[model samples]
Target chain A: MKILVCIKQVPDMESRFKANSQGVWFEETDLAFRMNEYDEYAVEQAVQLKEQLGDAPEVTVLSIGPDRVVEAIKKALAMGCDRGVHVQDPAAATRDPWQIASIIASHAGDKGYDLILTGMQSQDRGSAQVGVTVAEELGYACATTLVGFAFSDGTVTAKRELEGGIKGVVRLRTPALVTCQLGLNVPRYPTLPNIMKAKKKEIQTIAVAELLKEEPLATTVSFHPPARKGGGIVLEGDVGVLVDQLLGILKDKTAVLR
Target chain B: MKALLIGEYRQGKLLDSTFELFGFAAQLGGETAFLLVGDETRLPACDGPLYLAEAAECGEYNPDLHKQLILQAVARENPDFIVFVHSSYGWDLAPRVAARLKAAQVSEVIGLTDGGFEVGCCNAKMRRTVKPSTARAVLTIQAGAFPARQPNGTPRIQRLAATGNGGLEFVGYEPAEAKDVDLTRAEVIVSAGRGVGKKENVPVIAALARALGGELGASRPVVDAGWIEHSHQVGTTGQTVSPRLYVACGISGAIQHLAGMKKSDFIVAINKDKDAPIGEIADVLVVADVMQFVPALTARLQR
Candidate 1:
């Protein structure tokens, strides 16, 4: 069996973000980057499935970005993927989800992979659209926000998390796609030895232009920090006094309690 | 402009969020229509052309079958905008429909501006206005972002037939396991986030909740860390609660988490970082260590 896992490198969630000079996306120079938290679960799942299949399956990890994305692919390799593919596109950050998904579908359409995995959404765009678009582009069965996954006899059973804490169960035949969500599994840290080994692994680089099949349908008109509403009063002084004041306000004004 | 609102049906009925699309349609100033893969029983009472693909014919939510119906509806209606409620169903199907239509697609729209649709970016610390270059576009509005427009007249029903067989099988839904805790019903919610330190420290926040005669809630990080059960999660992916009073302890207020609880009557946030986004919406921002302050607050309340 063959499997493909798509990973994205996102700026750390806690970083101070600013719009780039182009006013299209966050400035990249000052931000620290790492594999998206959700995609880490996808890579971990792919690696686990390979291990479960006992050396029978080959896992290929793919990423799209400037050269920095090679690091993300390496992390997936360190976590036990067989190889890496990097679609080099300096303008990757500016491309909409449709353009990105079309690039991926065009590249992976004929790869003959039985299963494809991706994070539910990127930490940056958080659109949660690429995997499903890729599935539609490739005409594969698709499921999103998956927390549990099991595979046997050319079929996949995926557990999807819906709103209001409900779980939907779905079964899909092979040549399917699933998006990994948080709590799917604990992503493993790459051991020192594995990191060194992963450095030696082959990463095939392809210019994104060769795979591009669609223009961006959507474009960001402008980006800025969220507007601040009037600031709230800050409670100060002794902790005990703060509590009393808060309780009194809650009781007298909001009437949440007596 | 003409817009098609993709209605969602699940758990045996039409979702209430479906009506909010009409509100968005009104904002966009367009002639609106509706489409649903379920039968007439799930149709919304609205004044528009409603396209119905009965489950008996189309097998609702079978991606290919539903996509075919939507494509047919679009071909006939020629809508400029396709709107969906940014729920799980929308998250899955909107992109597929958009890809097939070769149309622009935007997800998680939180607000409408004269320039364009506003969406959260950079982990919700920033916002961006996006506009579609294409004449047609697909959009998924954030849950609860728009008010629901009341239905005054019945829709003109137009039935559609399914024509495709997809590779996925819809399995039964496993409802959230019955937990004694229901955050929605709680009058007060004292929520814990990563700052609670560890699993052992959860009881400290729970103690505060108990002392206040309220229920304990948690942010996505705490729940994802397995420090608390998923049932207690307060976020876009979890439970949306509007308690009378909300106490956010150590929660930095990610956009999704804020969406879940911002409607509370009164909110008090305790975090060491006064500039945390939670402070923006909080009625009172208390800058202090949650570990030290929560225990004292609980002790005072209990006394």
Candidate 2:
């Protein structure tokens, strides 16, 4: 089995963000980058499957971004993926989900991947569209927000998350795609030996222009900080007084006490 | 413009969020049609034509068959926009439909403006106004962002058949585990976050919740760390709650967490870091340590 796990490099959520001059995306300067938290689960699932299958499956991790994205791809490599593919796109931040999905499908379409895995959504765009869109583009059977997964006899059985904590069990034959959700698995930390091994692993680079076949279907009119909804009074001084002040405000304003 | 609103049906009834889609369609200002993939009993009352797919044929959900029914609806209605409430069903189906139609797609739209639709970008730290360049677009409206609007007048119902099926099959549905605490019904929620230190400290916050006559709520991390049950989680993937009074103890509000509880009538965030995003929407920012302050607050409340 050939497994392809798609990952994305997102700016650290803790970083201070500012819109670029064009007002389309956040500024890159002074920002630290890391693999999207959700994608970590995807990588871990793929590696675990490879281990279970006992070398029958070859796992390749793919990511699309500028040079910094190589770091993310390498992290997946350190997690036990066989190789990495970086589709270098400097303007990746500006591309909408449709364009990004199209690019990924274009590259992975002819690769004969038996299964594809991706995070439920990217942290930056939060579009949650790419995995399903890629599956549609490739005409692969797809499922999303999966928390449990098992494969046997060319059939994949996945436990997907539904609204209000319901779980739906879905089954699909190989040549399928599934999106990993949070709490799916605990991702392994890269050991020092694996880190050194990942440094030597091959990272095949492809230019985004070569893979992209469609124009952006959507445009960002503007991007800016969200407006505050008011009411941010800070209670100060001693902890005792602060608790007293908070209780007083809650009693006066809310019916919780009553 | 012609619009098609897809309604979600579960547990033998249409979800209330279906009405929220009606609310958005009214705002879009055009002829609106409703689509639900279920039997006649699952149909929602709407002013426009309603398309009902046979539930016996579709089962719980076959993504391919449902997508085909939606395509048939689009072909018959010629809708310029297809709308779905941003839920699990929409999250999985809308993108497939959009890709097939070659339409522009946007997810998690929080608001509509004269310029275009507003969605959160950069992890909800910023908002982006997006305009679809294509004539057709698929959109998923954010849950709770739009109010529920009941459409007036009778609706013409159209029956749809399952014409096609991709290889994907629905096996079954596992009901959620029995939950002892329903956060939705709680008037007051004292939620803990990673800042509470560890699992041992969760009882401190629970004590505070008891003092306030409320239930204990928790962020995703706390739940993921096994500090509490998943039923008590408050977030996009966990639960969307709007309690009367929400006390976020040591919770730095992530966007998903905010989406779940931001609608609370009164929010008070207690975090040692005063700059936490929770403070932005909080009515009061109680800057203090979660360990020390929660006990004191519980003591004061009990007295």
Candidate 3:
């Protein structure tokens, strides 16, 4: 079984992010970078699948970003991917998920990998579009928000999370794509020996112009922090007094209205 | 502006958010028609023209079949905008539809504005007003954000079977191991966060919920910590609720949690940190320790 897992290197969400002067994206110089949280689950899932299959099923990790993204690829390789494909371009930052999906599809289309996996969304963009778009472009079946995944009998049985607390079991054709959601699995830290081997792991870098030969679909106008929300009226003095105040309001305001 | 509103039905009934999308489509103005694919025998009455399709394989929502169904409907309706109520289904299918039609796509729009739309970016830290490059678009709306319109008029229903080759099978739905707690119908919810401190302290919070005769909810942290079931979790990946009153205890509201419960009619946030994002929308911001405040509040309510 051949599997392709797509990963993205994003600014650590915990870091204080400030938009650049143009307000188009974050000021990269000050922030730390890591694999998007959900993508780590995707990478972990791929490794676990390889271990479970045990007949030497290969897992290939793919990512597209600026030159710095190779570090994320190396981490995936350290974790256990056979090789890495880096679609490197300094300008890829400005491309929306539509364009990003196009680039991924260009590489993934002919590969005919049995299964393709990606994070539900990028930490920076959070559009949750690229994987589905890539699946659509390649004309493969797909399911998103996949919390449960197992491969058997030439088909993938997946548990998809739905609104409310419902979980649907979807069986897709073998050549399918599923987006990894949080809590799907715990990502393992790469061992020191694997980390050493990751140094020699081949990373094939492709230019963005070489993959996607089209104008960007959406142009960014600016990047800025959203309007700060403050001015919340806080009840002060005593906890008991605040409780009294809340009870009075709930009895008068909400209890009757509903 | 002709807008095609994609309607959703679950468990033999039309979802309320379907009407919410209709309301949003109405606000977008122009000819707003409704589209339904798969077994929609219990289809809600629609105000505008209805393009309805029924296919046997559409039971549990396979993205491949849904994409084909939506594309077939788009070919028939050919509206300027395709609207979806942001759900697991919307997140999966909308982008694919946008690709098929080359429509500019926007997901989770809180409001439609002039020139573009106002979207929550930077993890709800900032709202960006964006203008799409194309006039036509595929849109997935935040559930419960728009008011649902009452359906009225001579319902013109067009029965069209969406293209499905029956290659995929929806093997039915499996309810999570925990008893399913439907948060959407919860009129009042007592939600806790990491600030509840520890696993043992959750009962003290649940006491408030039981006292108030409301359901118990939790932020992602509580559920993720295995302190509570995922059935109680509220957020983008969890359940979206619009209870009449929401008591957020020890919850410094993250934008993701806000997405699930911001629509509640009244929100009371009790976090020690008054600067928490939850306070921004909280009607009553109580700057008190939840450990102290919640017990007192629960005692009073129980009294």
Candidate-wise lDDT, in order = 0.88, 0.89, 0.80
Candidate 1 residue-wise lDDT, A1-258, digit = tens: 999999999998767788889987888988899999899999999998988888789999999999999989999999999999999999998999998998899989889999999999998899999999999889889999998999889999999988767888989998999999888888999999999999999999999989997888999989988787875778877888888887777777676566
Considering DockQ, where higher is better, how would the candidates rank from best to worst?
A: 2, 1, 3
What TM-score would chain A of each candidate receive against the reference chain A?
0.91, 0.93, 0.88
Tens digits of per-residue lDDT, candidate 1, B1-303, equal 899999888866788888898888888886888999876765677787999888767765577788888899999999999899988888888999998888888899988898889998766777899998989999999887789886677899999887756778888888876756789999999999987889999999999999888899999889988999978988877788999989999998887799899999889999877667788899899888899899998888777
Worst 10 residues of 3 chain B by lDDT: B160-169
Tell me what TM-score chain B of candidate 3 gets against the true chain B: 0.77
TM-score for each model: 0.93, 0.93, 0.84
Segments of candidate 1 deviating more than 4 angstroms: A234-258, B273-275, B296-303
Please give, for residues A27-125, the per-residue lDDT of candidate 2 as tens digits: 899999999989999999999999889878999999998999999999999999999999999889889999999999999889999999999998888
Error of 2 at B198 (Å): 4.3
Clashing residue pairs found in predicted model 2? none
Q: Candidate 3 on B133-153: residue-level lDDT in tens?
A: 876788888776789887666
Better of 1 and 2 by lDDT: 2
Preferred candidate (lDDT higher): 2 or 3: 2
Worst 10 residues of 2 chain B by lDDT: B38-47
Compute the DockQ of candidate 2. Answer: 0.67
